[model samples]
Target: MLYKLNLEHILFLDIETVPQKPNFADLDENTQMMWEQKSQYQRKDEFTPEEFYERAGIWAEFGKIICISVGYFTSKGDSRNFRVTSFYGEELELLKQFKQLLQEHFNQTRHLLCAHNGKEFDFPYIARRMVINGMNLPYKLDLFGKKPWDVPHLDTMELWKFGDYKHFTSLKLLAHVLGIPSPKEDMDGSMVKGVFYEEDDLDRIVSYCELDVVTTAQVFLKLRNEELLSEEEIKKV
Candidate 1:
């Protein structure tokens, strides 16, 4: 099997999610139940998703997709540029626009969609939401059913499994270990809902998502020997 992906051919992406409401405490019983079940697995710290929703209220009222950010690395005359686009607002319309733009600008034969932890979260979330809105998925998304090695997918979280699944490493920790500065150290996924819904600061969410994709791209470069891995601790993980 060949393992060569043109850095230019890969578009890195990340997304932010929160509930559609203003407060989880204000959520109806059914919505609360839904959040509880989904949160059961997602919550690792002492706070369950329900508890976090009650405390933070971003996810409870914001309705999941606060922002979807995509970044592509472009090189021109020895200059490397990271170009980014962010989709935020009522999910249904923005999602359609995001997909349409991607399809118009990028095709499967040339560009491959990539993301961090995208297989489990970002990709599926986008696909399911697209289906919910009666939209067509991009061509490469259909490749998901094929063997992992055959697909264009490259998830850093899954890559971490090269060491062991026993220890969970976040994008921040991975970046730190690899000596890549995390542009998002000041905030994280947990704060996404609040920063977006409560503060009406969609840009922050977009920035956060963009940083995640950039970090994912950095991680991928290190993995592929396209870039240097600065920290020795990265090998341990």
Candidate 2:
């Protein structure tokens, strides 16, 4: 089914997020208590709220998107290329920048967002963050009454599922099995919180995020039995 679609119409993307505060203690008393209740089932008795706070980024309520990398395909005659770009810095500012890109360029019925596990994580997380930050919902990100078929969103992980509905596949593992290079050389999700707080190196995170976008696009191409983009073909815009 993916092979039948025009690749140029899809926007490949990936995002990185972290807890708003470095640690649970940095939050106010009420927020701390709220987190405890929210995370009780996930944390159980093995870890306290403070210790479980490290996993806060998984929840949009406790997290903020630090970086969003987006990519789209362009064609010149028979040759096709993919361009990747990123917005990273202050959370709200970066979100605004990304939203601007969407509104100015990729906002159209033919344009669809493609990401790994985007429907479950990336898409909703971005929408929730936008609302939380007092931003308007973009056409593609908004999910009012639009039926499942109407949503202009595509996910590589969901595609890979093939209706299994019982197993999970990591992006790195998919890339490996599909013969695409792994995007885990820099820092995996577990290490992102520490790197963002302790290392103060958003650049590293940005690079990692962009690789994910590129890898995700490659994964989609592979699924459709299409040619993968060469290194020289992927320009950073």
RMSD of each candidate relative to the true structure: 6.1, 1.1
Q: Cα deviation of 26 in candidate 1 (Å)?
A: 3.8
Off by over 4 Å in 2: none
- Expressed as tens digits, the lDDT of each residue in 54-95 for candidate 2 is 999989999999999999999999878899999988888988
55-153 in candidate 1: lDDT tens per residue? 332332325566777777667786666676778788887887778867887666667778777777777777777776778887666665777656666
**Candidate 2, after superposition: displacement of residue 69 in Å?**
0.5
Clashing pairs in 1: 17-64, 18-64, 19-59, 19-62, 19-63, 20-61, 20-62, 20-63, 21-61, 22-61
The TM-score, computed over Cα atoms with residue i paired to residue i, of candidate 1 is 0.78
Backbone Cα, N, C clashes tallied per candidate: 10, 0
Query: Once superposed on the true structure, which residue ranges of model 1 sit more than 4 Å away at CA?
Result: 1-3, 36-63, 143-147, 163-167, 228-237
Return the TM-score for each candidate structure.
0.78, 0.97
